[model samples]
Structures are given as structure tokens and as C-alpha cells.
Target: MKILVTGSEGFIGKNLMAELRNRKYDCIYEYCRETDSTLLDDYCKEADFVFHLAGVNRPKDQSEFMDGNYGFTSELLEMLKKHENNCPVMISSSIQAELDNPYGISKKAGEDLLLNYSNETGAKTLIYRFPNVFGKWCKPNYNSAVATFCHNIAHGLPLTVNDPSVVMNLVYIDDVAEELINALNGKENRVEEFCEVPDVHTITLGEIVHLIHSFRNSREERSIPNLNDSFTKKLYSTYLSYLPEDQFSYDLKMNEDYRGSFTEFIKTPDRGQVSINISKPGITKGNHWHHTKNEKFLVVSGKGVIRFRKINTDKVIEYYVSGDKMEVVDIPTGYTHNIENLGDTDMVTVMWANELFDPEKPDTYYLEV
Candidate 1:
């Protein structure tokens, strides 16, 4: 099917067009400010479905809001009428349409025009009264507070939230795109008079600020936010997208000396911590037993032998590990354990403990295995 999308470079339009192409839609006519006016006539004449997303949200002159939002919408409708194309047309309207402000009044005008066009041409119209729509590709420091907060917080800039108590209705761009696709398939969320996005999340300004801030802190704390939570997972994904291009990777502090280097990779509140332990050839580490803390060691590279002995028992247990065959050796509580590099090269072992290491209460007793 031939689909026409206006404002194709915009946040929602970009996401929608990408999804449409991914779904194998071959023909997509993109109309924007840069496109020639005559081409719009050609696209309108041949297009089967129209995604009318082009509009002015922030204009230097207040009058431009009506010109860009309502006036442009009228022009598009007239083109459709001239071409005798009565295919479905979906428009992105703001929740502010009910208010008396200039932008809101202009959006409402566009909505009324679409409804009138539908009445006259017997065409189907889908109008979405969106809230603060957010996701990746949204411009920062513009109209969306979520995009601004994500960009600023990810880049260590101060955030500005005037009213922390103000509640915001948020809709993810993916959901909006999916809903539009559903409209193309003749299944849309319709309330009384207007079509709507089916799902939305409501969060206070202060809560959203805190949630995004915690995501930044997770990098240092090594504790990941709850991905099982839908909102947090989506918000974290959005935050990562706003990270500066140059700052994609970070350095992990390595504790090094003579034997090799050991670095803590990640830590979780309930899942414990993961660390990489490197040992030179013939070098041995551990020789300690914990009363309550247990660990599991997996040798990922080089050859190694893991030895363990109970505190009071004379019996010794040994496990030969190597990079060729991966295995995890568990060190139970009250058992002294040690790992020695047997290969000519350095041995690398991944270690996972039950809790974060504490210097004050080591809970470890040194003993030979």
C-alpha cells in the first residue's frame, strides 16, 4: 500500500516511518517543509493512507501556530478533495486542544477541519489527542520535558523542573506508531468522538525526575534499575539513547599489583556482584574461607585448577578448568578455596559473590587449600 507521511523527519514521524518500512511497506511518500509544494499534490493524488504529522509547536510568532497547524491542515485537506482521494487520514493532535491557548486553539481548529472533511468526503479520519509523547529521536530542550531531562541528566547538566507536583500524561512513541498502524488496518482506539492511543502512563514531574536521575546513578552504583517494571525499562532505554556519542563506553577501575588485575564489572542490589579476576601464569589467589559469604568462579580463558578443602576435614577437592571447556566452581561457606593458573598464559576468571565486598567486616579467614 502507498502511505504518505508528512513531517517525516520529526520524532514521531521518524519512528513511524521506520516501523512501517520494517514491516515491509514499499512505498512511503514523505512530505516536509523542505519538500516542493507541487510534489505534495502528486503524493496526495496517489497515496492510499495519510499520516498528517506536520505542524508547528513552537513558533517565533504566535500567529504562526494557526498558520502552520490549522492553515496547513486545511491546505492538505483541500488537496485531498481536489484529487478525489478519500483514503484514511490520521492526525497527531495535542492534549492541550481543550485549553484556550493559541497553540491549543490552532490544534482544535485542525481537528474540526478533519472532522468536516470526513463528513463531506465520507473519508475515515483518525485523530489522536496525545500527551507528552516521549522516546528516542525526540529533540532535547525543546517542547518535550522528558527529552530535555534525559539529555541533561545523561550529560551531567542541571535539570529544570518548575513545578515538581505537576502530573504529566506520557505516551511512548512506539505505542503511538503501533496505534497508527492499527488504524491503517481498520482497528483503532476510539472513544466518544476522537481516536486515542490505547495505553498511557501518568507520572508526576518530581517522580519522573527522580526515576531518570537514579538511572544515571546506576552506572557508579553498579545496581541496575528494575527492568521488570515496564515504565522503568522504557525510560531507561530512552535515557541511554540520549547519551553523548563520544561517551558510549566507560572505564572500570582495576585493582592491580604483581599477579594481575581484578576489576568489579557490575553489582546488583539483590543479585550480588560480578568481578573479573586475572592471574599470571603459575600465580595463585584466594586461600581464604568466608563464614557466610560464598562465591562461584568460572575460568573463561587460559588453564586453571580450583582447589577447595573443608575447615576441619583433611580431604581436598580439585577441579581442572580451562578456556576450552567452561565450568563454574562453587566455593561453599566454611570451605577454604584457591585458584592457581596452570597455563603458560594468564588465566581470566569471572567471579560472582553473594554480596558486595566490605573491608570493615571481611568475614574471610585465610587458610591453605
Candidate 2:
């Protein structure tokens, strides 16, 4: 299907266009701010579907709001009429359109025009009065407070929140794009005369800041966020999008000894902890067993021997592990176990314990295996 997307380079437009293309829809005519204005007429004439996403929310002059939002919308509808195109049209509108402000008025005017056109030609139309949409590719330092805050915080820049107490209704960009695709297929989430993206979330400005800040501190605290929470999962995904390309990785604290070093990779409240361990040749680490805590150790580099022994039995079970032949040895509770590096080089092992190590109640006792 031939699809025409206005404001193709804008945040929402970019996301939607990318999603459409990823779905293998190649007949897309994109008109961004740089495109020649007259080309919109040809695009409107040829498109089987129109995504009227072009509009001004942060223009330098207030009058530009009406010109870009309402005026351009009227022009596109007129072009569709002139070309005798009865294609389905979807307009991106803001919930602020319910207000009496100039921007809202312009957006409402655009919505009215689309509704009237749908009536006039009996063409399918979708009007989404979306709340604050946040996710990857959203412009920073503009209208979206979420975008600005994420960019600033991710870059270590100072931010100014005029009203931290203010609450916001947020929708994720992926959800918005998905809903738009659904609308294109006539499977819209209609509410009254307009449509809505399902599962919009509400959070206070201060609360959002706290959640994002916790994501930043996770590195130092060696803890993972409660990703089971939907809002936090989406917000964390958005936060990572703002990180600089060069700063994708952070250094972890490493504990070193005569044997080698161990670094905690991730720690989760319900899933326990994962650590990377390195042992020098002829070095033995972890000659200990836990009463209740359990672990799985995988040798990823060099050769190693993992030996296990029951608390009372004299029988010793040994597993010779090599990096070329990766294997995981599970350490059961009450079974004393130790890993000894047997190769001439250092051995690297990835360890996953069912519980995080606790100093006060370690539940660990050293014993020869």
C-alpha cells in the first residue's frame, strides 16, 4: 500500500514510518520540513493511506501553530479532494485540544476538519488525542518534559523542573505506533469520536525523576530496577536511548586477591546475583558450601576442575571443564565444592547464585572438596 507520512522526520513520524517499513511496506512517500511543500499535493493524490502528523507545537511564534496545525491540515484535505482520493487518513492530535489555548484550538480545528472530511467522503479516518508520548527518538529540550529530563539526566547535565509536583499522563511511542498500525487496519481503539492508545500511565514529575535517577544509580549500587513494573520498564528503555554512544558501558567494582578478581555483573531482588570470576593458573577459589544458597558455575575460558563432596561422605565427584567445551556445574546445598584452574592461563567463570551474598548471614562455610 502507498502511504504518505507528513512530518516524516518528526519524532512520532520517524517512529511510525520506521515501524511501517519494518513491516515490509515499501511504498512510503515521506514529506518532512525540508521537503518542497508542493510535493505534498502529489503525495496526497497517490497515497492509499495518509498519516497527517505534521504540526507545530513549539513554533517560535504562536501564530505558526494555527498555520502549521490547521492551515496545513486543510491544505492536505483539499489536495485529497482535488485528486479524488478517498484514502484513510490518520491525524496526530493532542489531548490539550480540549483546552481553549491557541495550540489546542489549532489542533482541535485540525481534528474537526478530518472528521468533516470523513463525513464528506465516507473515507476511514482516525483521530488520536494523545497524551504526553515518550520513548526513543523523541526530541530533547523542546516541549516534552520527559524527553528533556531523560536527555539531561543521561548526559549528566543539570535540569530545571518548574513544577516537580505536577502530574503527567504518558504513553510510550512503541505503543502509539502499534496502535496507529492497528488503526490503519481498521482495528482502532475508538473512544467516542476519537481513538486512544490503551494503557496510558500517570506519574508525578517528582516520581518520574526518582525512577530515572535510580536507573542511573543502579551501576554504583549493583542492583537492577524492578522491571516487572510496566512504567519502570518502559522508562528505563527510554533512558538508555539517551545515553551517548561512547558511554554505553560502565566499569564495575572488581575484588582482587592472590587468586584473581571477581566482579559483580548484575543483582536482582528476586533472581539473585551474577558475577564474573577469574582465577590464575593453579589457583583455587570457592572451597565453600552454603546451607540453603545454591549456585551454577560455568567455565568460559581456560581449563578447570570442579569437585563436589557431600558434608559426610568421603566420595569426591569431579568434573573437568574446559573453555572449548563449556559446561555448567551446579553446586547443591550441603555439598562442599571448589573450582581449581588447571590450565596454564587464567580461567574465567560466570557464576549465578540463587541469593545475593550477605555479610551478616552468609550461610557459607569453607570445607575441602
What are the lDDT scores of the predictions, listed in order? Answer: 0.92, 0.92
Candidate 2's residue-wise lDDT over 23-73, tens digit each? 999999999889998888889889999988999999899999999999999
TM-score of every candidate:
0.90, 0.97
Q: Give candidate 2 regions above 4 Å deviation.
A: none
Q: Tell me the tens digit of each residue's lDDT in model 1 across 213-270.
A: 9988887776677777777888999999999999888778899999999999888667
Off by over 4 Å in 1: 289-296, 309-315, 326-336, 358-367
Pairs that collide in candidate 2 are none
With candidate 2 superimposed using the best TM-score fit, by how many Å does residue 311's alpha carbon deviate from the native?
0.9
lDDT of 1: 0.92
Q: Residue 320's C-alpha lDDT in candidate 2?
A: 95
